[model samples]
Target: MTTRTASARYDGMGRTGKGHITTQSGILTDQYYGFNTRFEDEPGTNPEELIAAAHAACFTMALSFALERAGFRDGTLETKAAVKLEQSDGGFTITRSDLVLDASVPGISPDQFAEIAAGAKANCPVSKLLNAEITLEHHLK
Candidate 1:
């Protein structure tokens, strides 16, 4: 197990601020993300979208490995994670993360696929790390 790192910097305060985010892998090198991107839907990325990407990637990889261990090697799993950010009395909070998966696995029963997918959804590292509510909806084709 290893540690991963990312950093962000903001140049101003509140809605007028500009920020940049960078990751260890350099996938996001000085990528812009700030008030406009987050609240106003301007160009660039945001924290919620980053969380969604992380969740989707982690869950899909976990399911791929689980399927391999279950003796089903050949399949395609496409997972999309939507993270919800809500504003309430307590300020802003990430309320939920919903995962929708489209899977194509040969020679597997619907029951078995559902079971495995559920297990992956429950046990994936990102899911475990999240403090918000997590829901998984999977479609097998």
Candidate 2:
């Protein structure tokens, strides 16, 4: 079997803790302000944040493709993915993923929006990347 390696890096400057997330090219992030739970930590960006970003971007791109295929014109797409982390008997694991989508496209109703969001959530590459289970609790508000 061939092993593929992907890299993400970070440098820390003691914003409040001892670590910061460095990009793959070696750039440190400002801070990790979570949209869920509002737990502000001075430490490096946690796994959940990275997962959320991946899921959001992936779902947005997939949703865009779906909209285009459905004859919808280009428009802004905003997405949020919340990753819930929990402790298990053996160790920690990702329990659930909740996604919220908002798009500014004409001629698309709430029902259509829901369908598109569901499609994206199921087919997004990031969603497929995880071995853990994911849930698409979407709200098109």
Candidate 3:
């Protein structure tokens, strides 16, 4: 089994707390995240954006492999995932993730592309991991 890990450290409490995140690959070493970064428009990363990035990357890679398995060799795929966080009765909850895909695959019909993209969106690890609603919109280029 393949497992990736990341760590987050938070000092202080509540809005005054400061947090740093680190990834196993060191791509995000000592990355800052906190109330200002999340609730306010501070210059730092936050959890929602990180989840979005993961979702986008996972879905795009899944689509690429699915396409190759279907005998398509060359193509380009770009995906953007938008994650929404809302205030729930208890606290805060992640409501949904919306994915937008721009794709260029030669000799692919709309119906075939839709089928493959839907499969990838449904089966991607990140998508399966989330409890929130997921939606996908794709454009053929």
**TM-score result, candidate 3:** 0.98
TM-score of 2: 0.70
Best by TM-score: 3
Could you tell me the lDDT of residue 7 within candidate 3? 100
lDDT per residue as tens, model 1, 9-113:
999998888999999999999999998899877999999999999999999999999999999989899999999999999699998999999999999999999
Residue 120 lDDT (model 2): 79
Give residue 38's lDDT in candidate 1 (0 to 100): 92
Please report, as a residue range, the 10-residue window in candidate 1 with the lowest summed lDDT.
Answer: 33-42
Q: Per-residue lDDT for 1-141 in model 2, tens only?
A: 745333433444333333334454344444433222124544446668778988888888998999899898857888888888887998677877777776787878889878887887789888888777766654443
Candidate 3 per-residue C-alpha lDDT over 35-137 given as tens digits, one digit per residue, 9 for 90 to 100: 9999999999999999999999999999999999999999899999999999999799999999999999999999999999999999999999999999999
Q: What local lDDT does model 2 show for residue 107?
A: 77
List the candidates' TM-scores in order: 0.97, 0.70, 0.98
**lDDT of prediction 3:** 0.98
Compared with the true structure, model 1 gives a TM-score of 0.97
Clashing pairs in 3: none
